[model samples]
Target chain A: GPKVLQIPSHQIIDMGQMVTLNCDPVSNHLYFYWYKQILGQQMEFLVNFYNGKVMEKSKLFKDQFSVERPDGSYFTLKIQPTALEDSAVYFCASSLEAGGSDYTFGSGTRLLVI
Target chain B: GDKVKQSPSALSLQEGTNSALRCNFSIAATTVQWFLQNPRGSLINLFYLVPGTKENGRLKSAFDSKESYSTLHIRDAQLEDSGTYFCAAPSNSAGNKLTFGIGTRVLVRP
Candidate 1:
């Protein structure tokens, strides 16, 4: 089975600080995605990246959030000046292709902003 | 409005019993995917469906694009099956972003 690895399984950060989450997607996967799940709520899509560019993003992807995968390295999501509402489990997923392709998800990085 | 809605927000099932989880979609979804989030918060991909049915070992899943719904059936449930089951559909035709359901929490009791 393919695996997406997320670094820092749990993180506690102060509000207004910058935090970056790292995701090591499957080596052969080309499409990457980020999802946010608040405790006791449904998971929401943040954004999707392909070919080093953001393809699509949802309203939940605030202006303070950004994503990049430099030189095919670990895909990273950075949030600058984070807010308390940003505290949630972030799950990263990757797929070989888009359009009905199966996705492999990471265990998730639980970020707690205090 | 909820785009992807799941039934029976929580369920308690006895081991070796069978249970079925369902998801009704409000968006125009061409495909459906089921995932099981374990206690450790791992989203394990269970099934990727394309308006059809698929079975793997003790689990079975079906997606009806015309009906805008999907179903996941767990047969002869085991303790390991206790988890939060979620069904998701792509937000766009490219299938890039996924909209997930609230999830059905299943607690398998011995």
Candidate 2:
């Protein structure tokens, strides 16, 4: 099965600091997505990317959050001046199409803010 | 309100038993997907369905677009089947983004 790789399974950072989470989506997968999971809650959609542009983003994707995949490299999510609510497990997923297809998800990165 | 609502927030089943999990959607979904998240937080895609039925091993899934609901049935469950099951559906409201339900936590005991 195809896999999506997420860097740094766990990260702890101080509030108001900047942190970047990296994801290596499946090769040939054009649609990339980031999901946030708070403890004891469902994984919520944050953003989706395609053709080097943000195709869509959810309300949870704040102004401080940004995503980019440069030169076919890792898809990275950067949070500037992180807030307490930003502490959650972030899962990266990729798919060839948005409908009638399976989406591959990574192990997820757990972010803790103190 | 949850766009995708899942029933039975938690369920427990004995090994070799059978159970069914369901998801109801408020938004019009074009597709449906089911995933199992292990305790280690690894999400494994179990089923990707349109408006039809798919059977894979001991697991079977059915999606009804007109009814706006989907179901996953596990037959002959095993201990490893214990995990959080989530049903995700993508709607026209959000471009290419799947709305996930709160999930049903399942525990299989011997």
Please give the DockQ score of every candidate, comma-separated.
0.81, 0.69
- Give a tens-digit lDDT track for model 2, residues A1-114: 889999989999999999999999999999899999999699999999989999888899999999999999999999999999999999999988765375889999999999
Query: What level of docking quality does candidate 2 show?
Result: medium
Q: What is the TM-score (0 to 1) of chain A in model 1?
A: 0.97
The candidate that achieves the highest DockQ relative to the unseen native structure: 1
Question: Which stretches in model 1 have alpha-carbon errors above 4 Å?
Answer: none
Q: What is the TM-score of each candidate against the true structure?
A: 0.97, 0.97
Worst 10 residues of 1 chain A by lDDT: A95-104
lDDT string, candidate 1, B1-110, tens digits: 99999998999999999999999999999989999999888888999989899999999999999999999999999999999999999879788788999999999999
lDDT of 2 by residue, B1-110 (tens): 89999988999999999999999999888789999999888999999887999999999999999999999999999999999999998855543688899999999999
Candidate 2 Cα misplacement greater than 4 A, ranges: B93-95
